[model samples]
Structures are given as C-alpha cells and as structure tokens.
Target: MADFDIELDASGLNCPLPVLKARKELNGMKTGQKLRLIATDTGADKDIAAFAKMTSNPLLDFYIDGEKRYFLIEKGAN
Candidate 1:
C-alpha cells in the first residue's frame, strides 16, 4: 500500500458526509497523492467505492481497522 500524504477523520459521520469530505479534501491535494480516511459510517464502504469510481479517484486500499473503516485513496489525474 502507498504511504499517505494526508490524513482525514470522518468518523461518526453518516451517509454522504464521509465521501463528501474526502472529495472536498482531495480537491486541494496534488494528483497521485494518497489520503488516509478513517470513517465510522456503515454505509461508507459502498458509498466511497462508488464515489471513487464515479469521480475517477483511485481507491488504493480499503479495510476495516477494528471499529473504523479505513480507506487509502490516491488522487486522480486531472
């Protein structure tokens, strides 16, 4: 897995918030950079997956770390 250049905590958020925040954060990041996102939403897995595909972001890794869901996403080429 790639090392993260940024870390975001989206825990306790629900629905689209986590994905939305991740999108917002990625907007300021350099392309190809990795972001480590920690979220607690049960729906985040599917939402983030779909969002990554839809937005052209590469989901480098995804796994559950204890009670939280971890996502390693690489910024897309613009």
Candidate 2:
C-alpha cells in the first residue's frame, strides 16, 4: 500500500473544516504528493469530493471504516 505524504486527522470536525484543512495542506504540497484525511462527519463524502474537484486535485481513493471517512488526494500540478 502506498503511504500518504501527509496524514490529517479531521475526525470530529464538521463539514467545510475538513475540506478546508485538506485544502490548506494540499496547497503547500508538491504535485503528485498525497494527503490522507480522516474525517468523522458523514457529510465529508460530498465535501471532500467537491473540494477535490474544485481544487483540481485528484481524489485517489475513499473508504469508510467504522466511524471514519478516509480520503486520499493527490495534489495537482501548479
């Protein structure tokens, strides 16, 4: 399994915050670097997807295990 370059725990944070924090981290990452965000908000499914689309980053993978929503994102070229 590919390890993420950055791991962000957004669990317990609500909508927008997770996506926003992911964006902030993604903004500083180089192209091709991956970020893993773990969120507990049920709404993260939509928020993270839209954030990736809007930011032009690629949503590498998404999964739900127990109460956590795991999202992998690759930073897009500048």
Candidate 3:
C-alpha cells in the first residue's frame, strides 16, 4: 500500500463523478500529496488514470479488492 495524505471514497458513483470529485480534492491539496481514492465504478480504472494524466497528477499506484477499485494519485504542480 502507498502512503497517502488524504482519502476519498467515491463508491457507488459512476463515470465522471469519481474523477470530478478527485479533481476537486486534488485541487485543494498541495503538490506531492497523495490521494487514495476508493471507487466502485469499474470505469474508474481507466478514467482515474486519464484524469490524473490530464491534470498532470501522477497515478502512483492502483490495485483491486473484489469489486472495489483503488487509485493512488499524487498531486502535481499543475
């Protein structure tokens, strides 16, 4: 598991919801801080990665536990 500064549970949300909330959280976080996002939407695997890249935030790590998807995102200067 990766060390994270904050955690966001976007479980049950679909599509852009997870990404949108993550973006909102990341925007308030300082650079280099990591966010642990817990989501149930299967689309989050790709969506979160794309969102991270698009925002310049690094997707540090990702893993799965049953139906749940986990993403570790580190805030970027942008």
Q: What are the RMSD figures for all models against the true structure?
A: 0.9, 1.0, 0.7
Off by over 4 Å in 2: none
Give lDDT tens digits, candidate 1, residues 12-61: 99988998899999999999999999999989998999998998998989
**Among all windows of ten consecutive residues in candidate 1, which has the lowest summed lDDT?**
1-10
Candidate 3 stretches with Cα past 4 Å from truth are: none
TM-score of 2: 0.94
Full-model lDDT, candidate 2: 0.91
For residues 1-78, write the lDDT of model 3, one tens digit per residue: 778999999999999899999989998999999999999999999999999888899999999999999999999996
Alpha-carbon lDDT of model 1: 0.92
Residue 57 in candidate 3 has what lDDT?
Answer: 98
Model 3 misses residue 54 by how many Å?
A: 1.1
Q: Per-residue CA lDDT of candidate 2, range 1-78, in tens?
A: 258999999999997899889988988999999999999999999889998998899899999999998999999987
After superposition, the stretches of candidate 1 with alpha carbons farther than 4 Å from their true spots are none
- As for lDDT, the candidate ahead, 1 or 3, is 3
Which model scores highest in TM-score?
Answer: 3
Q: Please report, in order, the local distance difference test score of every candidate based on alpha carbons.
A: 0.92, 0.91, 0.94
Q: What TM-score fits each model?
A: 0.94, 0.94, 0.96
